[model samples]
Target: MKAIVFGSTGFIGSHTVEQLILKGHKVTAVVRSHSNVAFLQSLDVRIVEIDYSDTASIKEEIEGHEVVYNCIGSVGLRSKIDLENAVEIDLTKKLVRAASLSGANRFIQLSSIVVYDFHSSEPLDESYCIKPQYLIQQLLLKREEVVRKIGEETGITTIILRPASAIGRRDYMSFFSRLFQQHMNDQFPLLKNGETKVSLVDTRDVGRAMEWLGNYPFPKGSMNLFLLKGFDTTWKSLKEEIDYERGIEVTICDLSNIVEDPVSYTLNTFRTHRVWNDEKIRKLGFTTKYSQRESVKDAVQDFRDRERI
Candidate 1:
């Protein structure tokens, strides 16, 4: 199988490209410049250089691939959309348009579980339309809808995978992963009510899910792929684990004392408590190799081993 991946040098994209190549599928990794080239080269993936935000260029570059995986995403939060193409309307539209024009057989859009508004007492499912609260989440929801429409109208076999908090070592850390790093280094000051629960899925699991979809033929339409975050962990537990490893309780800045950067600690940590439902993904033959504790522990260990903390 010939597979093409956008943002192939990114955290999840690089991992996905490696998995595809290991499975004997020739992989074409999209990169924007020389820095992107080095990372994809480390994976030994075929490189295609194009601006991810450009439609005509992406269409030209995306041709002749059996499947295209939209793993492109903004790495972290920001105040404005133009600073980075993080906003969904501008960012996702480019990818979707390219895939539609490319006429690929399968389009696997790697999306976020945050699309569903996290207000449910029960586990969140595909049917739930609570919508995204924050800026990034809102953009993802719009992107998902547009992808579904393209699949329906053009007969593109579109499969959407919404992984909850992808875990594993990569060139960069995720929004939460950075915060976790901060917690480990005593850099995250203002630890307000650290009770918020987080659901995590190993990046290996994400790779497996992509492989599974590549092998299995999907019906002509769209499907929501997700791993329910059944297991939940708190920042306090994460801190405990780090403390056990380092033999020193990392300093957690007082929550009560407020400052300008309140969102970094207080607001973000408070909102991460929502759980994700992954039953849909399990029904499709994907199993998580790492349990919540195991994955988190391994992630924390990686941080220490790499001296990222």
Candidate 2:
């Protein structure tokens, strides 16, 4: 299979490219000229710089690629919502349109579980009602809408994957990175007595799923969505793993009452027990291979290596 991935330098995108190559597929990474390609250069994939503003140019780049994987996203906690939308929604619009025009067989979009009502009393699935409250969640919802709507009109097979909080070696900027840094400084805090269960999926597992999806046969013009979750574990357990990795006893702080960054922390952490049902994807012969503990250990080591701790 020949595939092209946008935002190939990002946390998830890099892993996707790696897994695809390991599976013996031809992969191409589409990135901007100003973006860093150092890590991408290490992989056995072709790298191309394209101007996303021109849909025709994007189409030209996308042509001859059987599958187009969109791992582009803004995971920054404090990014302005408009900027997030521009990257998440506007840029995605161009990419999907180009894929449709380029005769691509499938378009896989990377979405988040936050698009669902995390306040649900039961586990979330594809059927759960979407009630995105905050700005980031709202933009994600819009992005999904754009993909599905355009996919239907263009008669292209589109798949939307809502992955849980992704963590691993390449997690440069995300909640887990911040959490690790805070833990290293003994400033990490917990909500609900550090027993809040977080839905986590390894970035490697996410990449493997994308590789599997690339081979799965789907009817033309069909749209499918799935939730991907590796395992669910509590903050206390995760913190202990990190504590063991760093060889330091972390002083657990409780911020349940304060809720410092309510918007980001709420959804990222103990906001109404954000669990997901990924049976749909699992039934399709794709399941998580890495556990939360393994991912946490890898992340801790990666951070230490990068920071020279």
Clash pairs detected, candidate 1:
197-273, 227-278, 228-276, 228-277, 228-278, 229-276
Leading candidate by lDDT: 2
Alpha-carbon lDDT, every model: 0.68, 0.84
Residue range 1-309, candidate 1, lDDT tens digits:
888988777777877887898889988988777644655677757787776556788788778887888887753455454423445556566666677678777888888775655456455666576645566666676677778876777777778877777667663658547667676567554354566566767776677678777768667555545544435666566566556655667777565555454354235545446567677767866666766556656666776666753
231 in model 1: Cα distance from truth in Å? 4.1
TM, every model: 0.82, 0.94
The candidate that wins on TM-score is 2
Q: Model 2, residue 200: what's the lDDT?
A: 88
lDDT of 1 at 300: 66
The residue ranges of model 1 lying beyond 4 angstroms of the native Cα positions read 52-56, 82-91, 171-173, 187-193, 223-231, 245-247, 254-272, 297-309
lDDT of 2 by residue, 116-168 (tens): 65556467789887776677777788889899999999998999988898889
Give candidate 2 misplaced runs (Cα > 4 Å). 83-87, 259-268
**Model 1 misses residue 294 by how many Å?**
3.9
Model 1: residue 82 alpha-carbon error in angstroms: 7.3
